[model samples]
Target: MLALVSAPTNLGLRPPQPGSVPGASKAPEALREAGLFELLRVGGAREAGAIVPGRYVDDDATRPPGRVRNESALVAHALRLAGRVGTILDAGDAPVVVGGDCSVLVGIGVALARRGGTGLIHLDGHTDFRHPGNSGACASVAGEDLAVAVGLHWPAIADIGGLGPYFAPGRTAHLGHRDDDERATEARDLLGAVVSAREARQTASATTAARIHAVAGTGYWLQLDVDILDPDVMPAVDSPDPGGLDTGELGALLRELAPRAIGASITVFDPDLDPDGRCARALVDLLAAPLTTLGSALR
Candidate 1:
């Protein structure tokens, strides 16, 4: 059976307020309404639920303190969710998690790591590994989430699921990264063997699939950040960069990878930034392919 989980909290960055942001509030609803879970449930899916992370509304005066609490809350929530999902996996069921941001990977990585050494296929425009004191044009915590998961920044993200160094360099691979900030560059240097967007474009989907399969060797988790798509093609994102994979290419890659990898999860961010639901729908379609397989298998 497949257990679908939803984490609707944007921890590192705040999702734009409803009505103010074009499609933010409706993104999660769209996922649910699109029959994402219903499709999974069609074949006697074991369980499903949406989790609301504790809100830590950003405040200037209490920003520092708030971040401390917010990170803790996010970690706690992730651990709780991981434990729940782990329980399902222990019983031989696959877990599919829908997320509000890439930060949710902290928990997912830890949970997967607990089962065994799991490989990572991180699909994003940026490496998402900001060091503790790294300064950049956009100094946002969201950019550093991958670093935290990999144990680059311990203080900020240490206690999530008691899993440190969630993934090793050899166990991790990146695809569709077009833009690189200083922090991202540092992360790439620290963790070698990342496939660039140009390379992904030059390489066929089959080649990409082979590379991921080779690197992962066996079971692995897929961390998808919607910002990896071209801004023109997917305009709604907290951090949109130009020159990313197209919908068709991305869908093909996911479809190819899903069957090869042992387990996987996806995260969608900044849906509020979407203007006309173009990005949201595209994301849903991209995910629907593999999810349908999961549904069929469990059914």
Candidate 2:
């Protein structure tokens, strides 16, 4: 069975403006309002309640030198999120986390680290690899999740609870990054498996799944940043790039991947950008089938 967890937090993202909070914080409720919970319930999922996050504070101006935006708040949220996910895992249910931003990966990483040697299938439009080593624009942890997850960033975010390098690079697979991503070449060299969006479209879903499974690791976690879908189809994300998977392609891939995952986190769908709820409905429709059968392989 899948346990639905809502980790509605936007602490990792830079505010749209100085005083405004990132709208992604409302993603969980928006998805619920669009009837995602009902569909999942019909598919035999139980709601696991929500993890309320700390208040969003745009500390950009006053942020300490080595810290990202909302550093303390983000860490606090990840700890709480990890605890909830851990509880769901202990109960023998796969968690399907509805998230506020890509930084949710940090929490999931911590939870999986506790279990020992779980791989990660990172499905995102961008590699989200910018760290202090790579770029000076490191304020948004959401933009650097993959790096942090693999312990490529500062100790504060990466070594949460002293569990640094949650997923080893050799055990992690990155899929759906654009061919032109600045980190594409480096990620290919670092990660066990790296598949570009274009390559995935050309390859069979099973083949892609096989590539991920071939990584040197045990059970894997699936991280879905909705921007992996083409901006033409899913423009409501904070960063919508040009090239990405279509709804059908992503759905097919997820169907193949989800069942093999121990748990999955869905992130980066901004309801504020989807005012009419069309995007939310589309997102729910796209996810319902694949997520409904999440972790089936384990069963």
Candidate 3:
């Protein structure tokens, strides 16, 4: 059985500028409305409920500038998600989590940790290890989820579930990161067996999975960020960068990886940007393939 979970919090994104729709929060419903659940019929599935943020206060006196904005709500939100995901795992069902953003990974990490330390597979275009800024200006805490999970960021998030550094440095593999070195410098210091986009091109997905699994050992959780797909095919993200794998490449990777994952989450596809509904359908089609195989394997 598979438990379909929804996390609709966008506190990780840049705050809405007036009338703009912070579209990521709408992803859970959008995906369901697009027939994603029906298309990938498993033993069971349902929304895990949404977590919209409330209140924002600057705490520059204690926190680094901007890191404190929505800090309390986001941390509490992750714990809440951890509880929900823990229940899903305890029920002996693999979790197919849909997200509000990458920050949801913190909660997923928390849940996985209690099951006896798990490894992580992060598939994204950007390294997403953007350093927590010291410029006294607000930087996104949401974007640094990987950092937080590994104990490089705030202690509050890193220490959730009463465990620090959810995935060991040697156990995590970050693949398909095509972003520049400057953005990933801090993050690079902490990772292991990171496959760059260039290296990923030369290596097959199964080969990559084997290398990652060797380190991950027993099991791992897969984190899929939609922005990892090329903007030409997945242009609905908030920060679409240049150069990414096509859906075919992504599907191939998922097929090789998903069956082995204890749980997985798909993040950052904004329905508002996909005006014609093409991206939504495309996402469902792409996910349905491996998810079907993954569900059966889990069953």
Candidate with maximal lDDT: 2
Q: Lowest summed lDDT over 10 consecutive residues: which window, candidate 2?
A: 210-219
Q: Which lDDT value does model 1 have at 220?
A: 68
For each candidate in turn, give its C-alpha RMSD to the true structure in angstroms.
3.5, 1.1, 3.0
TM-score, candidate number 1: 0.85
TM-score of every model?
Answer: 0.85, 0.98, 0.88
Steric clash pairs (candidate 1): 24-272
Taking the tens digit of each residue's C-alpha lDDT, what string does model 1 give over 1-299? Answer: 56777777566564354323222323456666656666557755545677677755544335453243256667777777677667767877667777767777777766877886577778888877665556432223456667766776655464454667777766777777775544556656656357777788889889888877787655667777777888888877777788888888788888776664545666555555654666666776677666555423223
The order by descending TM-score is 2, 3, 1
Between prediction 1 and prediction 2, the one with superior lDDT is: 2
TM-score of 3: 0.88
Give the clashing pairs for model 3: none
Residue lDDT tens for model 3, 237-262 = 98887778888878888998888887
User: Whose TM-score is greatest here?
Assistant: 2
- Model 2 lDDT tens row, 6-87: 9899998889888898999899999999999999999899999998889999887788888998888888889888899899
The lDDT values for all models are 0.66, 0.90, 0.74
